[model samples]
Target: MRFHVLTLFPEAFEGPVRHSMLGRAIQRGLLSVQIIDIRSYTHDIHGTADDYQFGGGHGMVLKPEPIFDAVSDTLSPYPTRDRHAFPVVLLSPQGRKLDQQLVLELATAPGLVLICGHYAGVDERVRTHLATHDISIGDYVLTGGELAAMVIIDAVSRFTPGVVGAADNVQEDSITSGLLQHPLYTRPSDFHGMTVPDVLLSGHHAQIDRWRREESLRRTLENRPDLLDSADLSLTDRAFLAGLGYVGISSLLDDGFESQE
Candidate 1:
């Protein structure tokens, strides 16, 4: 997968994307990222990318011309009419909240153009005409969209087949599986007074799998019970959750799951 980031502060991306999993993915040719400085497209001598709003806003709004030119120039090489044509995404607090489902959707794209909004925000024209999608990391605001773009890049890359070492790893990821991941313990099974669960140490694969499922449910119930309503739960799973006093099981049934009882 390829990601093109359009930002005024292109220098900000140098460290984050060039290290960790993203770096390794680039090295192996599983993914590619191109940072396009929005200022470069500006005609002004100072490379001015923002200007005071016409209606007298507190912060400068990103100019439409530079953004439009940058995106158009990037997309000019590809057939614009195709379904797989690169998508232009503007990262803004006003956008739909990013989630596992949206990440899955973006991973399928051949490439992505992420517009990192700054100051007051990108011009309305940029969002209305140029951007194909607008996405937010969460409900809150950020100083700029650069961090959010990096986050989307990392997440979407995970679904690009070879970026992650194991296919099962992607499948079993916390939100991808619709539940919080079960706790993991390694080495020093006996620490202080806490001992590793015997099922994990017993070399009993079936019992270990059962323990993991139950723990996953317990953690999700305790931390994020809302997930269980949409998680693909087996009758056995529901029974386990019910036994643990997860009262939201009724909502799951209302969504059309057959009651285990």
Candidate 2:
């Protein structure tokens, strides 16, 4: 997968693109990131990419010319047939909430163009016409879209082959799995007064699998019960959750599994 990031603060990405899993993916040629400085496409000598907004705004708004030109120039090399399918994303607080499903959807694209809006935000034309996706990391606000762009890259990159070691690692991820992951323990079984669960050490694969599934459900119910509304749940899973006082268990039941309640 390839990511073309358009930002005024190109230097900000120097660290993220060079470290951790992103770094490894770039090294292995599984993923590539091209940072396009928005100012480079500006007309003036100072290369100013932002300007005071029309009809009076509190802060400067990103100019549409530089953004449009930058994106156009960055994608010029791609075959014309695939250009229409490319995702041109504008990171903003008012856009679609970033989630695992969206990340997976973006991973299917051969490449992406991420517009990191800054100042008061990009011109309305950029969002309305040029950007294919307007995405938000969460409900909260950030200083700029730089962090959000990095986040999208990391999240979407996980779905790319070889970006993460195991395909299961991405699929079974906390939010990706539609549930919080089960607890993990390593090294000495006993730590201070806490000891690892016996099922983990008993070498009983069946018992261990059951323990993991139950724990995953318990954690999700405790931390994010909203996921249960549409999470794929078997009768056994729903029964387990119901035993733990999940009231929504009354909604439906799978075939051949009568409610144990």
Candidate 3:
């Protein structure tokens, strides 16, 4: 997969994407990232990318012309009447909440064009006319889109095929399956007064699987019971959760009602 990012502060990306899985993906030729300076496409002699808002605002808004020019110049080779066919994502507060599922989806795209909003934000014209989709990390606001872009890049990069050693590593990842991962223990199986679960040490694959599933349910029930409502559950899973004194449909519905209230 290829990721093209347009930003005013291109220097900010010098370190994060240069190391870890992203760096390795680049080295292995499994992924590629190109950082384009939006200011470079500015028509002004001073390379001015932002100006005071039209109707009066607290901060300057990024000019749309430069953003459009930068994206257009970068994606000029691909011919697509539907702009969304290529994925032009703008990081903004108004965007859909980005999650693990969305990350997995983006990782499969042919390429991604991420626009980093600055000052106040990109002009509405840029969002409505140039961008295909908008994504926000969470409900909270941030200082700039650069950090959000980096976070998104890192999160999605892990899902790219061959970027990680094993496909199952991410497939079973927390939130990917809409459930948290089972606990993991390494050397020093017996630590202090705590000992590793006997099923893990017993070398019984069937028993170990049973233990893991139960633990995953327990953890998710305690931390994020909302997931169970949408989780792909089996008879065995339901029975196991029930045995653990787990609350099912009742708790799930209650959470929903509380939220609406």
Q: Highest TM-score: which candidate?
A: 2
Candidate 1 C-alpha error for residue 79, in Å: 2.8
lDDT of 1 by residue, 1-261 (tens): 989899999999999888988899998999989999999999989999999999796999999999999988887777766434678999999999999999989988899999999999989999999899999999898999999999999899999988888744988879898998888889899999798888899999999999999999999999998898788888788777777756665755543455445
TM-score of every candidate: 0.93, 0.94, 0.89
Global lDDT of each model? Answer: 0.89, 0.89, 0.83
Candidate 1 vs candidate 3: the lDDT winner is 1
Worst 10 residues of 1 by lDDT: 252-261
**Model 2: per-residue Cα lDDT over 224-246, one tens digit each:** 99998878888788878867867
Where does candidate 2 clash, by residue pair?
A: none
Of 2 and 3, the candidate ahead on TM-score is: 2
After superposing candidate 1, which stretches have Cα over 4 Å from the reference? 81-84, 251-261
Per-model C-alpha RMSD: 2.7, 1.9, 4.4
In model 2, where do residues sit more than 4 Å from their true spots? 249-261
State model 2's lDDT.
0.89
* Least accurate 10 contiguous residues by lDDT in model 2: 249-258
Shift of residue 222 alpha carbon in model 1, Å: 1.2
